[model samples]
Target: MTTPGWWAMALCEAVNDKTPLAVAFAGEELVLFRNAEGQAFALEDRCPHRRVPLALGRVVAAGLQCGYHGWTFDGASGRCTQIPNLRTNEPVPPRYAARAFPVSEGNGFVHVWLGEGVPDIDLPTDDYRPVGQQFTGSTIVNMSHEQYLAAMLDGPECLLNFAHVRMTDFFLGDVRKEHGRLVLERGAVWTTQILPSNFVVDYPLIVRTEVPVQGGSIRVDLLSEDETPLISLAIASGANRRGTTSLCWRGFVHAEVPAKAPLRWRTARVWHKAPFTVNSLIDGSAVAALLEAPSRDLHAARPPRLIPVSAVV
Candidate 1:
């Protein structure tokens, strides 16, 4: 499966001098390590010989060494440099190299390019600081990657559905049954304003970036109310036998609920080919925009001119 857009794989601090870090993103297991010079490198976690996880080994002056046979690989090039047990005259095969990935660090996060060919856009360094309290957690949801994205883009409308109201009320504190206005903008960014019936000055503005992943999954950066990083989520299907969605929260200000729990939704209700209402055009159009150009050159594509529409509940 081909993944579209740049993915924020891990926080910059995830890789340090002590040891290599292993991470799974877009169905690929990668190991991140810092060389002796403190430069970061990402390589396929498996060692070609004996298939031992390289992450389990120590970071040597040469590169990452396999724990099984003490074979060392070049951190940047992924080329095998040494085999401890090889004969004095024996030559290492040319194919003994691990797959390497392009990595960049900025904005307190590490970004990995998972797509084929060259990266068209630089790693995003946009600020996403939280305005209030921050909370971070991960949860597993029973749904496909596409199904998970559909549920997220469905937004508050899905929360107001008769089948979902009981659950929504628990999280949102009796939000009025209303439709929010969605505005799609350039650079694949969009915003939604949700006004609840009870709160006069508490309308929440949700801003989201659509970062598509392989296997129809998505990684999104979400902000609520003026650059407040509410959630940075990586949504994928079958990450385990059950689908998994990992999230980090910042500036989440729901006073009624002291701590947020993993919220589950029936995928069958959220996954639909047709937009339930005109307001849902954002979801369909967002998917269309992603499909139109699966290349890394999405930012250079023509800007979509969509007329903002209001959907009444």
Candidate 2:
């Protein structure tokens, strides 16, 4: 269901105006402004009369006015109301309306649900952790946001599995460092799956983190390991920087595990900014195997040292 490319959230600078709702769009994210009005009028970025970006204009008198020729457009109906050159007595001209879309905003960002037709999709605004400190932006993907959720559920193996992911030309390499390791690559797909229980927790958490300066990467996920969940939950900022935009993916999961009266906490973010690819390969279904892996897997006072969180997830 992934239409193409990756544009799952909001734009970086769309939320500058807190009181006056702003307009922003990119094929997938045609959301309206979010100001005191708590109002979002979804619409095509094109101008029906002259095709100027209505987003470049400002909101006026319950609608938006295009600056190109002083043509004003209604937010809900995409109608052109006043053309300065025309007389007031003249009725509104035909074929002068923009395409208005349906949009909603919450969690400090706006969202557009893109498709040929409108369906019964409702946005949920609860129990979600913020990126860094706030909601960055919002978007309406041409495909299903649920698919974005599904990607995380499957883990990165789909892209790693030899039977699954492929590209024009690829290479899978196995190198032996002081410790155990294996690396596989084909095109842009690079993955490393480690095994451990650093991801499971005994208490509620904001995704404890760390970035060790080493050749590897470590992440402690509070949610599922497959679907490569790092998408829907991670703080996206500088990920695809080499591309037109950069994304920083951050995922979060909170649950109660068996911990001591007060469990000690250590994170493995050290590998976050490392070279190549890095992530833990965890099969939690083997509880007996995991329980024997490390007490860090458990919340109670069981072990002295623990593996990174990403390894255990």
Candidate 3:
């Protein structure tokens, strides 16, 4: 189940020059590390000899050194640079190498290219632009990647929450395609607002969700009734071991606050606390109760990943 695109594997800060970070995405195990010059790289976790995980190795001046047999591999090319106990006359075999993937870093994430050739599109985080102090977190949810995505659309409320805001069932509009993603919007209101016995006139807030058509990168926004942005989040998700899904997110509260916001919301902003949270524990019952809404269009309209011609070259 390999998805051909730039998948956010880990937070950029999590991968450093001192240690190798192991991550699994789309069922591919990869070891991430930085070179002496601080350039990030990713390689197949298994070493060619003994099949030991390269992640167990250490970062050396030359490159990543295998823990078992002292085999060193170059970060850029994943070619074995040196072998222990080799005579000066004997050269390292050019064929000895680990599978390497292209790496890109931006918007607080380390993205790895999982396609056949050069990346033909912008990175999943290209549109991410955080304003103030950003809150971030990482976790593995006990759900399959496909199901996780389905739940994101079917019931985002079950997966995450916005402080002082209550998401409503009223759909703003039908799901639509926008810039290679499926976008949905729903009505929302302040948690402190009292509902009238009769039907309310209009919602005071809005919750917008944008999910990519192919990859697992998702963007969520909380906006005022007039579409003023209040909070924005970027969530990177992918498959992990044992039918679980890996998730990492970065988000921030906007400077502008709604006039109708509660005192707690105002205090949270002044104290610089995160205005939203990505749930580490999902509710199974809530997920089961959610009707398959916009996700139906998402699954049906999603196109297959196409290998660009450059990959063959």
Candidate 4:
């Protein structure tokens, strides 16, 4: 049940010439490996012959070789290249090929096309350009992917936190579609400042979140009151196993630090430390309390498309 789009499967550095990396999306297992020439490829984890996971195999000069039996698969096409006990003149059956997928890499992420035919869309990280040292991490959380995306729109503070900053419940604008993503803005303030009890017209900080209508690539930015970007983060999210969600993120603190930032924020930037944290332990009570608003619009904005059954094979 993979969604029809190019999903960021893993970081480019995670897949290499020596090892096969195993990842899952919507319960479908995929094995990622690189050929001897450093070309990346994705294949259905199962070997058609014995149904053993190809990820459990090893990479050879020609392609990935199954560990159970010495069967080898070509990285580019998933064609069976070698059979250990085949007769000298016998040719490998053309129908014995393992399923292969279209893979591309850029912006430090490895993307796999899960849809039918060719991908007509840009890579999710196309707009992401980091200016300095990047802080990155990966984790699997105890939440469903759909719930996680809905929480991102309703309450992002429960999923992540920026040091010395407090995210308020005030949204600056309605959720709107921009460049194929649902963009929402919220008001934020430094932890040192006390929130006024009365209605305030302005906020000292801004937090903008952009989520795709199809894929799970999300972008978050902490900015000044005037929208000067302070920190930018790109998150690749999808289903892992069971009801849990997989998350991988890379972000950088922008060079233009806000003048009103606290001393701790300044020191962290100077030491090249991560200014934000994506929570591995989400607060269940807080998520339950979130008022569903913008996510309703997000659900409406998404266009439905049927995933071709052949793509899964």
Looking at model 4, the pairs that clash are none
Clashes of 2: 47
Ranking by lDDT: 3, 4, 1, 2
TM-score of each: 0.54, 0.43, 0.93, 0.93
- Model 4 clash tally? 0
Q: The CA-based lDDT of model 1 is what? A: 0.46
lDDT (Cα, tens digit) per residue for candidate 1, span 1-313: 3333345555666677569887665456778888877788777789988888889988999889888889988877788888997887898887788777777765555665565656545443343433334332233333433334434443423311111221111122211111111112111111121334344343233324343322222333434335444344332222322344332212222222112211321232234211111121234343343332122222223122111121011
Candidate 2 on 200-296: residue-level lDDT in tens? 2321111211111111121223212121222123322111111122222333323322132111111212222211121223233422222221112
Give RMSD (Å) of candidate 2 vs. truth. 16.7
Q: Report the lDDT tens digits of candidate 3 across residue range 24-96.
A: 8777788999987879998889898788999999999888898999999988888998999999789998889
Better of 2 and 3 by TM-score: 3
User: lDDT score, residue 250, model 4?
Assistant: 86
Q: 141-213, model 4: which lDDT tens digit per residue? A: 8998877888888899999998888888788889988888899999988887765623456888999999888
